[model samples]
Target: MSKSLKAICAVAATTLLLGISAANAGKYNLGRKALPEEIKAWNTDVRPDGQGLPKGQGKVSDGETIYNEQCAACHGDFGEGKDRWPVLVGGKDTLKSDDPVKTIGSYWPYTSTIFDYVRRSMPFGNAQSLSANETYALTAYLLYMNEIIDDEKFVLSDKNFTSVRLPNEKNFTKDVRPDTPTQAQQKPCMKNCKTEVKITGRARVLDVTPDAKKE
Candidate 1:
């Protein structure tokens, strides 16, 4: 190549390398370090104990309007899930089924989870679309549809929120295991010490004849 051509190429390469380095330099840095207020702004998660939930009120009746405008397209008009989207109502007795049809009232353990889940991720493609009051109304409507709360009941604001009880609330339990090892599981290893691992058997194939398998 000519001397001029080589010089131009070297300059171009240096400029490209510098641009890449500058673009990625911030990626490796500690990252501007989020301010305390900024952190608080994004971390608006509400706990099951009714902590961090904003001050707002929403009734099932009000929720109906919001649902039809924003949610009915994906989550059926009656909260019945569309084409395997996710059903939000019914399933009162299917928690123990082989293919359990779980809903907020049937499997969820607390009402706060509904608020937290909806606030963080919901409306399918558009997340964080609803405000605190809207989320409250939607949650209340879902509860009403699941038969856990009355349609006229209001669920919002911290005062009334904590009082709301989910249907599957009785399914939860506290972990009572001791910090250290307990007598029930810590027996001294003696006889069948399992010196080495061994593969005993393999599953049998039903109809495959070692060829022409469905991929």
Candidate 2:
């Protein structure tokens, strides 16, 4: 019956009510679980191990045909690229250059990535329109253009997908962040961070920012 006891009881009731509301937050029958078919439709991503590759086959010759028809407008006839579009083929040994040409041949780490990318999004405006066979053929053509595959008659499919590997595949190393030493582990330099500070460059002289007032 005391004022403090009444206040304490009211506070306890409010806390209990809030706990109950929080427990039943998402219990409303708003949305149903996605069907298997619905999930399959969106889960079209292919993996490095050729897990999601559909049952289909294609040759380099067939890929050239598909590439010319579907891909040549944006990417050139031989994947040289049109205007400022991405160049798909050639760029061997250019990774260390001042302006490196990162084509499928020189830079791509895996062959599966090429197939997956082309299958999912390619031909510029028209995306995801290629069949499994078309994707395989295009992938083959790109490999041939890159000189990875000697025989144009070579057929690429889910069976032999892993056999074809990119040249730069060996260059790529696994992320060693977990085992590698980090800067945080080193002793921090709180005082005298540097012996002397020098002006390396001037921002005004660099002219990195555009003269917006001129417009």
Give me the candidate number with maximum lDDT.
2
List lDDT for all candidates, in order. 0.81, 0.86
**Residue 121 deviation, candidate 1, in Å?**
0.8
lDDT of 2 at 93: 91
Candidate RMSDs in order: 11.5, 10.3
Estimate candidate 1's alpha-carbon lDDT, on a 0 to 1 scale: 0.81
Consecutive 10-residue window with the lowest summed lDDT within model 1: 201-210
Candidate 2 residue-wise lDDT, 147-204, digit = tens? 9999989999989998998988777777866665556768867898999899998666
lDDT by residue (1-215, candidate 1, tens digit) is 99999999999999998977765677564445568999888988989898889888888887888888878888799888899878888788987888788888788888898889888898767888898889989888878888887647555566789888887889878997685666576887779889799987644435445665654
Q: Which portions of model 2 show Cα errors greater than 4 Å?
A: 1-31, 174-215
Query: Model 1, which residues run further than 4 Å from truth?
Result: 1-36, 153-155, 173-215
Instruction: Give me candidate 1's TM-score against the actual structure.
Output: 0.64
